[model samples]
Target: MAQRDYAMSGADARRAVETGLAAAEWYHTDIPRKEMKALMARADQPAIRDTGLLFGCMALFAGLGIALWPSWGSAPFWLAYGVLYGSAMDSRWHECGHGTAFRTRWMNDWLYQIASFCMVRNPVQWRWSHARHHTDTIIVGRDPEIQAMRPPALGRIALNFLGLLDAWQGWTKMLRNAAGRLDPDEADYVPEHEAPRLIRVARIWVAIYAATIALALATSSLLPLMVIGLPRLYGAWHHVMTGLLQHAGLADNVTDHRLNTRTVYMNPVSRFIYWNMNYHIEHHMFPMVPFHALPRLHDRIRADLPAPSPSILAAYREVLPILWRQLRNEEHFLTRALPPTARPYRAELHRHAPGVPAE
Candidate 1:
């Protein structure tokens, strides 16, 4: 297996375009236009109810944690708060960024901004970055959000559980953007017109973080920092665990979502926190469908998708080994075994030439 470059400026990106993999037409399950329209319809009720639960829980946990500070009782409350703030916010940011989480445009933007702050992601930059992700998902040189690149950085992935690497990179990028410097990869996806807005948002984020730090110092307590800054590091594991199953060892540079994306059935609590993003293949196939409607969408397209992993544990069982194998054999990938009812994979149309393997 050759060492394949995953950087946006690398040869793979140029190859993806030349090979017609970048922004190429992808496979979609056939559905009646009227039925699809109904599924894609945005509604306020579901988003409203879910948002209420999320904020309500965060308030409850934060209040309890604050009141019980310096006591063991506060530990559980803070733990709960961290997961909601750090982990759940990832999904919220994702769905809201798509502007499909709520029927109301302002509602989506409001939550998107809040969640982006919680996750330490620049909303303006990620909006464009994610658009590229959807346009060229898992394409080696195109998608900016490829979570685990091959000959996988095992150490970095481990540190990311504590949000160490991601926080460092995110804060560094934020500061750079605040300094009016956009990285080449970012400039590649984000429009020139959006650069000013991105810088402004980054500056605002830096100011808020500075304020939180000052408050912590003024009080001679860690409370403010714990509340605003630290949870992203402490509570990131759940999202990282689930997020890794998405495309960790899947084929890259491929046009088919089924080849690179995964759908794992998770428990009810996980579903709520992940905003139903567990139905990842369904979400990728029809991004316009709201998170609340993913299960219904999954049912509609079940016969056309690979058999979903029965649980998160099941997904990891399959994914972990593939990742380990890829450490030595970068060309190796788990070709999802689609069900008999599913559409056959177009192997010939794969980005790699016939008899040549894709990285």
Candidate 2:
């Protein structure tokens, strides 16, 4: 496998455009119009109920942790709080950024902003970034959100478990945005008109973070930082764990989601934290469908898609080794075998493509 640059400004990005891969049409499972409409329909009730429960749990965990502060007994409560505040917010930012999480526009916007802050993502920049992600799925140069680039940066991936690399890059970008200068790659996806708003948002985020740090210093305690800033580091493991399963070892520059995405069946608790994104292929195929409706959408398209991994453990069992091999072989990737009941992969479409070998 030839080493290809995954940077937006790199050769692969240019090749993608020249080869007509960037923004190319993607494969989708067809559904009846009425059924698709129903699936895409947004409702406030489900999001409201889920949001209430999420916040309620966060509050309970935080209260317990704070009351038992400076003790080992607080560890469990803080751990729960960290997962909710740090890890769970990643999914919330994602779904709400799609504007499909809630029927109400303001509700989605509000949560998107809040969750973006929790995850240390710039809401404005990430909105367009994710739009590009869906539009270009796993196309190396075109997709900004490819979690693990080939010849995997294993050290960065390891540090990202604690949110170190991600946070460092995010804060650096935030500072750059606050200075009203967009990095070239970011400028590629984020519109020129949105630049001002991105700057303003970044400035606000910097202020809030500064305030949190100041409060922590003033109190001579870690409570404030733990509440606001540190959870993103401590609680990031779960989301990173689930998120890497999304596209880590999958084929890239392919039109088919079944080839580039994994759908893992996760437990109910994981489902809640991940906002049901484990139905990843379903979400990618029909991104308009609300998160609450993904399970139903999965059922509707199950016969047309690759069989989902039975569990998170099952997914890792397959992905981890592929990732390790990819360290030595950039072309090494998992070709998800589809059930006979599922539609055949679009092998002919990618037969001549470099780096994307047919299974």
Model 1 agreement with the true structure over 158-196: per-residue lDDT tens digits:
999989999888999999999999999998888999999
Model 2: residue 117 alpha-carbon error in angstroms? 0.4
Question: Which residue window of length 10 is worst by lDDT in model 1?
Answer: 350-359
lDDT of 2 at 225: 80
For candidate 1, the per-residue lDDT at 222 reads 94
Query: TM-scores of all models?
Result: 0.97, 0.97
* Local accuracy of candidate 2 as per-residue lDDT tens digits, 16-84: 899888888888777889999999998999999999999999999999998999799999999999999
Q: lDDT score of model 1?
A: 0.89
Model 1 / residue 347 / CA error / Å: 1.7
